[model samples]
Target: MESRDYMNLSTDKAFPKLLNPGESLLMSLKVIKFNKRNKAQERTIALTSTSLLNLKGKKLQRRMDITSLGGITRSKHGDEFVLHSPSEYDYRFGSPLKDQAIQTLCQAFKNLTGRTLYVWESNEISLKDLTTTKSDKKKGLNKMPAPETAINFRGEVPNFNEESKDSRGKRSRTIFAATENPSAALLDDFTILKVLGRGSFGKVMLVRRKDNGQLYAMKSLRKDALLESDQVEHTKTEKLILQHINHPFLVKLEYAFATSTKIYFVMEFMKGGELFYHLREAKRFPEDRARFYAAQVGLGLGHLHEQNIVYRDLKPENVLMDEFGNVYLSDFGMAKMLGENGSTQTFVGTPEYVAPEIISCAGHNITADWWSFGVLIYEMIVGIPPFYDQNVNLMYELIQRGKLKFPVKSPVSDNAKDIITKLLDRDPTRRLGAQGFNEIKNHPFFAPIDWVALEAKRLPTPFTPRITDPLQAENFDREFTDEAPTDSVIPENKLNMILQNQEQFQAFH
Candidate 1:
């Protein structure tokens, strides 16, 4: 049966009442609504002077007050628009007559609230514009505040002071006032050199600071995509964790700042690139070499667990190496802070490395990272994960089965196999590192590792990359390095539209 049929039957049984009296409809149109899961459903949107109603036939599905409307934005290349609501999740709708629907709604909103609705081309909307009122102006909201000359890390504000200085040691500063272009003001200090990586929502580039000529990796993410996907809170959490934690085996965040359209994270550049790249070239590593990398990663995870932060994502791709082949855990996007003995129900992690508890939705804690660590160690010695399968569902079933097997002719020691079995236990309570990281550190497989010397980085590295120059991209994938490394220019009008939404990223710094 069609999905619309299900909607009709559901609405008929729940809501039989029609529109309220004196609330006449002004415009009714068939539209597609994108729900929280991003699935599209057919519904009728009726716009009135007092409210906007979502309906199926004569049954009401949802009603939004017109007076409470915040803002409206139209997509650049489609008949789609997002209705911004400060008090609830933003509503996304698409219609064949999108222009007419938006025009009629905006007219009604302005007539009722005495505020003009500015339709932005992009999906960005300003909450400041939505929540501000004439009464707020009476409270002196129009005054200009003092410029910030010194660096303040309390709120994670950007280091604008660094950008304000020149080669001559002279300093000039701007207040980042409402009329100024914030993106150009902040990003102009760095010269983009190459594209380091790309993902669905953003890209990472190798950039150089103009003042000291130091190299760094700058990650840029789109604000609209983050909001549409409901990842705003996750992004904020990742920034906070990165800002507070400082360990030798963990990647360090040097700076974080946001523009009207994007957020940027400046991090120390790792010359040797991701461990995954080198692992693929070498196929697999010897037991001793694998132990070296695993020990460092264990220490990194242990440090995070000590701070009550769970590193939910752990895999070869996130393990980065320096020129001397020292590993550092990167990408804390999935990490979260929990209260004492707390567990989270969010289903996240790479499919192959996901823990059994996460798959069953049983709630997970720091022990989940131990499961992924086991998978990483097994893959490092065997050239692939223990339960790896091309079919994701079957692979998950294998993981839940909690079976551990070694190749018949493999050279892996008994100590290695024993540790893997304990860490891969189906019961999180019985996992090797469930009690504390010291259990894993004391395992016989890592007996050769001098824990004290390793943690201090005093021991010599087992391997080193053939790096001839600091600026060379030989260690990184050629596909990313060959691409043009230019930050796209935002139109002046679009920039203004994004500036209005700066309140959403005030803590990005």
Candidate 2:
């Protein structure tokens, strides 16, 4: 492994062993780390790689500096550039080095490494031209190559025009969510800090961007599994929903991209863990504390409804908090976007939170969120859903019966009971927020809430999780932490089928 600064590259310096283009070399970079004040600098870069891809049979150690595969490509932010190939676009250099500048670096490579005629080595001509140049005798232009030592690659010349362009181009990106300051943050932009959680299909990983050291949650889903399980549409739905919605109380999709095998969604890291984890430990929350949490969720849901989005899944597990106790709604696998007066008859949602309309296979709209809100509040107050039962059918019956039964032991307030009652109404038309969130926001239960300040995150939370570090996983379930991450075993036949039908999952990127 070599540790060298790109700025200090000189042909006279002895370079590391030169290998074939595709051969995995243990690449490292030299960088200067400094505090926010730009003081106390350290000239070093981490010996880490963000890519999970194995080059052939060997591991490829990638870095953001020194040298990158993707050539310097223009960015939407004018001269701002991202360098890397389109296929294995591993590293995106956020800034520095341009066309002619790249030629200068290649000169350094030639001087240090001792090679002649580097293939696709010039910025003025396409890489293909390097291998075979057309002869034009009329113009008296001679086919001349750079003399002596050169670098060459087995693969075709990288499309410099589209090098920075990801699978999701600017137009495709607009199909999902719009961002004021869109994330140029690719999946490879962040190094995997830890495996946060994993399921049958994919994983939620803790990642830190090399450029800014900011932490985020990266959810990598297997495209093959999504296709095999017939969940391609669900995956697309989640991405589209996330792109359209953004709020402080809602988890934001910072960036999204996909590879041949996996799809990734980069999101804000909620360090406080799932609300269910805390609820299970405490048994239940007091009215005031529950009210505070519920209000935060309501604001999030209300905003979604305002955008004509219905959060079909609203449970404690999806509610996450930051170190400051600011709660956000995460996981939009079941959320759907409907136009004004638009509705869907999708029988989706967790059994407990599923509205009667959804279970009945009748068309449902934004009103469905109100019912989930009722179940969530009930669980917060009583530590158990109102219709808790060992039998699934019995639970469904309880929900359909529309019976408002409260535990005798619970000293529920009139305002609390009043809001829950209206929300859990069997008739979707009569439910709180049916007309809009205005009906629910005006309820006495949330009278203390200042809509503006709440949105501004001015209200003090009742509880802040004991999260001193973003990497701390104490609040999370040990089962997930302790379990070894199992690899996805996709049958070759299934993978081929998914590729043939790749158009179905196009929205995922």
Candidate 3:
């Protein structure tokens, strides 16, 4: 039997005791009860851990009751609110709801022999019998504040079959806030097939337009996530860039929609997956193969810079290609629009691919993207990043010093190394800027590259898929491997929720 199968059959009940020294399980706590006026009755109180588990999938909320309460209350008289509860009394909590029955009794004793209350014991075991204290409770006033969540409705409102329009009705001009874009609606002709990716913000899906049966990629981000990350401006900036810019090498935005819960972007789907996964699988590409991809990316970056937009994140994962071998730059989630002088201050980028200036939290321009391009080209020729370390701190220090080394045994040409050296120059001013790509294109490194022909998607790809089936498990490689297999925790429910929610999201507009 497989290891996973064995695990499924095992019922040792020892998993909960597997914590190592100094390791502890942390669970986010939410209030299960509220006091009068719908406020948190008490800031801190002890409750059984099992009680929290009962509220597993429920959102935290408050309720109010006008009845009497024994706990000390905080009112306008804050100075005299503090008081000690009765020393020899038993406190209790009662609930009238069927599923919400709660009873917590606390008996305060002044000392060992101060007082005693007689009560007959029932033969049944109590919760206190099962509770075990490994150590004394840590002395501290623990404060837990509930997180604010912005709702992104996941269902659509029902529509009526009857048309409400009259034959001679007058139409009035309606303007949406800021831009005159239309509200979001479901494209009845398209079907969402599978989830492409998911993150804290939202998710991406593989969709097929029923009109032409053409596959397209759709990315959806919840407005709450944007608001929480304080990246609302960043998302808006990407929308603006997508609106004003038009380039073949860049991922084209087909359409966009905004709902109360999320914003969706429909774009051309790249079936070839991430460039990173391809490079990892092939080990390393030949110099010509590397140059072909690099040149296409550089051209795209150059076009973006010309339009005054900076692609802050330029790692291989953000670069994509279609099944036909046409490459395009994607992931504008971290992109930024340049100021009047074409400048930006935000420090953002993937660590291995980030420019040194960005690491130091200093300002940089389109030149930063070129530097990252240099690192990418180097990585393409070699299987590993130029400066990688097991320790991330050491890696950051090495990057700050701008140190990149190449193996002598590697068959990469000298011209490729020269371009890398120029691009990796620590000084941003002399760091082979946007025009450096032109210099590289004319170099002997790309002697066989017919730039004009390649841009038109006519050039043949050096590496063709030995396996033609798109859904083949082996064809997915590192990119889709995790999603290809299903055992436990396969994210099937999340995907279903997203699909069902998409319908609701379409109507939420």
Candidate 4:
């Protein structure tokens, strides 16, 4: 297709509105609907100003709100497309004019939502990309080239053990009996001090416990938003993991309680702030400093693995530092407990650090975390992810290719490069730490690290944050700390919504 084909395609002058009042038909094309259980049926897909309508002859089969769409994914060949919805099943469609269809949808979506409709390389879209807006255009959203890379196939590994037990040898529960009343008293234990960070689900705040007068980082999540995004189970998993795991390099959960409209997690406040902030300020860390941080994180991952849990999301942002500069792995929302000798097929993780197995839709285990570890090591020393590209699709292609290259100016040590290359191996079975994290700890790069001392956090850190006050969050982003620290008032009408779904979060305490 020519570039001009996508121009002026957002107007309804060329197509009439269909199915809805005041909705203009942006594009109409014949597509083959691929169903796993049923045969591929021919259908007409109409992209309107407000919704995407799938029609079989004169009957409408499905109508998806354009605003509800998470993103779009195109097959390596321009013959198939997948419409991703945040709250619904992905709709797969095949068409000879797939390129035209994608362009039309992107243009129309951008025009209607005032946001760029990202064309993901795979169906596993990152939550970060799903919530991105046009303000991220400079980061190169919606700028992928036509599909040309060959798709690699891997057999799906089935996990026979469906559920895993906790340290007490009891099956984990998603919803438990309420241990505390859902009232204002739930939050009265902690005095809100400062806003630490904010996200789609809720915000993290610095708080002081009224009973002990100890400071903590309280993460508050909205119940309605959790139900809307279908993340109730993941939230429960995070709570379960936090309650069981204890390590010097892992953030500890001090308390967990929920109100009628929100769930709260009180954790040890890492005064040194996110490693991302420090890394950005320093531009890049020296090999010695990077090794110091990597060793702690490796131990944290090792502990989680020993408990049969996988820390799938490991990045600089998720790694926080204490006042003494010791790093701790935070955020267990993406972490999961796998059964013995079992793997999961869930596609979740930051795109830059995602493993090749995850991108291929093959089952993945703890080894996936090793791949992210390698990416983090490379990024720490080189100042950017090795496979990073402005275009996300091209980045994924580079990741699958598994080519290792060092920057010409960055003087990475031979040992560092060796460990990174071994971890970035395309085959998960051959990847470093596949057998165990002992292999990683014994690597020549980490030879200087004293495992015993590091695990106990007795080793001196390379950097220590200058914290002037225990209550001040000078190391955190000012954008968040400057905001009001009060919890949002729930509307009287929304109280009914919270009551209706109270059972879903009964065990949250």
Candidate 5:
């Protein structure tokens, strides 16, 4: 394919108009790449390039420095560059000059330590059955793309189902807020106070916004790990779920942002720390204490269920306590919004709390949460899960058997046992609240607790953590918080494994 020289396209809007298939736009740009190195690690320099092309069949061959991008934004509209549309799409080319030009700039982007470089359509449809006017004449719109590839841009296809939620077919409205247009603040906008938690690929940092003095727990994910483990989809799902769900007992995701090597999740910081930390230290909660926590979590889970969501991971570690001891379910890595009639066969969740059906390879639903809730209540009062074991294989065997034998020495109440028994029923269909949470709520075990008052947080909690200051880090393990502060580094891969797959994680925020 060859480039065309006819230039009569409209230039008023940010994108192109109906110029048909063969027209080309002229664009002049400086192509450059960033060879950003892990400052924490000493390594040989790696180069990355991005190419920007002028559709005029001329290549911009200058290796522009990356650091001085001051005029780059201005040049986009300077009688040269053709601005792309807001929604992303592949610009398939007969000759691919636009695609080739863009790819060349990307190829030229190299040397993160220096900047030589690099930086980064609509219509409607006419449903005339062409057989009458077009097919007979053959000179009208018959020359357009084949009907199979005729999906022109006309905004988004509307879903008019009764239970459709937002544009994503969820069962809720306005689930995503300003997340679509995220906060302009960068990682430097916050002052890192201390490390709150750490994962194999990243860490959660307690940070205070320098502008407003607002405190938020930022979960940082390493780009390398995300691509290497093939977890880009999982990461995107977690981010989207956090943006979609809103409830009192659910942890709020304020903002999410991404950089070249890391993606950060800014969240409301829960001061009281992990329920597991409290559970481990306290050894066990009293019946009333356990009841309060369980009831609060029940509301959180119930809210998710109402939204047709399933909280696959419901362990104590993922449930956090605020200063008031009000619990909010966190970590949606395993949580998903299953539509009105959706179910998955994927095995997820903590082993000890995983439902029997999941292990049995039988499809499961919200009932899995009730089973986990039973394990949660048991562990809260008894200080350990029923299926506790050093061996994971043994744990799976026990989980499959689906047995719960309360310890004889423990003082777990009979009412509690009754509720746990109903929840942990091997038969998921017969499980408490398998049909609805009312069965669990109306149980005698929760007879004394007021569900409405509990949700309003009016009922006094059985425990409240002692948090004196915003910078407190005692709630997290010393092993994590004590690790000398890191500068958000990922081990460099010389084999190009992580870098090649980085496309999956682009533009998270």
Candidate 6:
């Protein structure tokens, strides 16, 4: 082959190649040995091209840099080169460049010299001696070494030895025992600094474990409050849900303990603040920043679905941000696992975010989670829910009708609008769930994200909140607690009154 056309060598510049079908070229690489002078001492090795094509200069510049793909560096002795190829170009381990670029150059040497090359490509192998050697030497390379272990594989019979100890162990426990009291265990060990957030049946406190001095959020629920309110089942369900889910993006339940009066759940302390605070204060997230948070929430939802758990609650208030601005799904009070062919019948969830199926009291499953996810996405971008009404019943009716009226002046992209439209489909069957999220990750709006890598948090978030320093937080903490009644001032009797008489407290229920 002509050096100009075959090598595609243009002056001193090198470019990758293209080739016509069935055409091949031989490459004569001068692997010259160098001494102290940086000049060739001796030797040259030749390799035939398996494929070749010349790319236009501009196109070649865009190709991924493969220099780090693994190739020989200068030898310590300076007598020989390291003899390797870029990992991207190589497929087989030691078959040489003729077959694939990654193979060891030693194989090429053996092929050229009509001598055998023995390299331990891996620690173990097996070989059967042929009654006679084959004339094709290339075929001989695919043999086994002295037998250290043998594994026989035949079609139908399954093997028992391959099972893992973990796989063989008892199935993972998905639920914790429900208790009438969780307060004694949680309160006796921690000093309640202040109440962070409170629900009708439970209260989350910013507390420090006295023994370890470790700060935590202690969620305390009076057994009488939960039971008298007929929310015991839901509370138990939340504990079970938290016990089953262990993911980075979801709030972790450190432990659950109870006293005769109340149940207490220890959870991770989120110091950065709340998603609601960010959204309300910032007005709305910029496109890229919103995408980052949305992607993370999608991942957390995906994990929940994989474990058959549905996070019925998906609102900015239910999501907490850590110091690094990582969103963690916090409240799982309404979460439930859909058993095979099972669904939830309760009509529960935040009115603006609940799905039509949920409001209708039709059996609902994980798809309800996606509907709320859509509402959340809209709120993140527009600074308001898509279907908001001052009247709670009207809001549910609007959501049931699946009417999402976007503000004409809103700056959201059409791609996002399209995704939200589909995700909020009244028919749960058509709403975005696991498969739908995959489509979303590929949308042009998120084209820049390395989806697999982003899911792993290998990439950094484009927007992070500016949070108070730990020391400043300490000062804020003191002021924040001053607004609420002192923990000691409530006294046992007054605390019981607040706990048992839900309607009596105007601010609470």
Assess each prediction's global lDDT (C-alpha) against the native: 0.71, 0.61, 0.52, 0.73, 0.60, 0.54
CA displacement after TM-score superposition, residue 285 of candidate 6 (Å): 1.1
User: What would the per-residue lDDT of candidate 1 be over residues 1-509, giving only the tens digit for each residue?
Assistant: 01112123334443324556765456665666766455456677777767888886566788998876656656543446767654544567865356666667767776777665545554332222222233444554521112232122132212111221111111111000001112232687799998887653477888999988999888887775555444667788888888889999999888777777888888889988888778877878988889999999999999999999999878887888998889999878788999766798877777678899987779999999999999999988988888875434456668988468898777788999999989999899999999999999989998999999999999888789878986766777777888888875554654654566667677775
lDDT ranking from best candidate downward:
4, 1, 2, 5, 6, 3
Quote the RMSD, in angstroms, for model 1. Answer: 15.4
Better of 1 and 2 by TM-score: 1
In the order shown, what is each candidate's alpha-carbon RMSD?
A: 15.4, 22.9, 19.3, 14.7, 21.7, 26.9
- Tens-digit lDDT string for candidate 6 (127-180): 111111232233443232222222211211112222232211111111111222
Q: Find the candidate with the highest lDDT and give its number.
A: 4
For residue 76, model 4's alpha carbon misses the true position, in angstroms, by 29
> What TM-score quantifies how close candidate 5 is to the native fold?
0.63
Model 5 accuracy (lDDT, Cα): 0.60
TM-score of 6: 0.58
Residue range with the least summed lDDT across 10 consecutive positions in model 5: 169-178
- Ranked by TM-score, top first: 4, 1, 5, 2, 3, 6
Window of ten residues with lowest summed lDDT in model 1? 171-180
TM-score of each: 0.65, 0.62, 0.59, 0.69, 0.63, 0.58
Query: Candidate 4 residues 360-411, lDDT tens each?
Result: 6689999999999999999888877788753334555678884688977878
Taking all chains together, the TM-score of candidate 1 against the true structure is 0.65
Task: Give RMSD (Å) of candidate 4 vs. truth.
Answer: 14.7
State, as a TM-score between 0 and 1, how close model 3 is to the true structure.
0.59
Candidate 2 vs 4: which has more TM-score: 4
After best superposition, candidate 2 residue 204: deviation in angstroms?
1.4
Which portions of model 4 show Cα errors greater than 4 Å? 1-185, 491-494
How many clashes (backbone N, Cα, C below 3 Å) per candidate? Answer: 1, 12, 4, 0, 32, 18
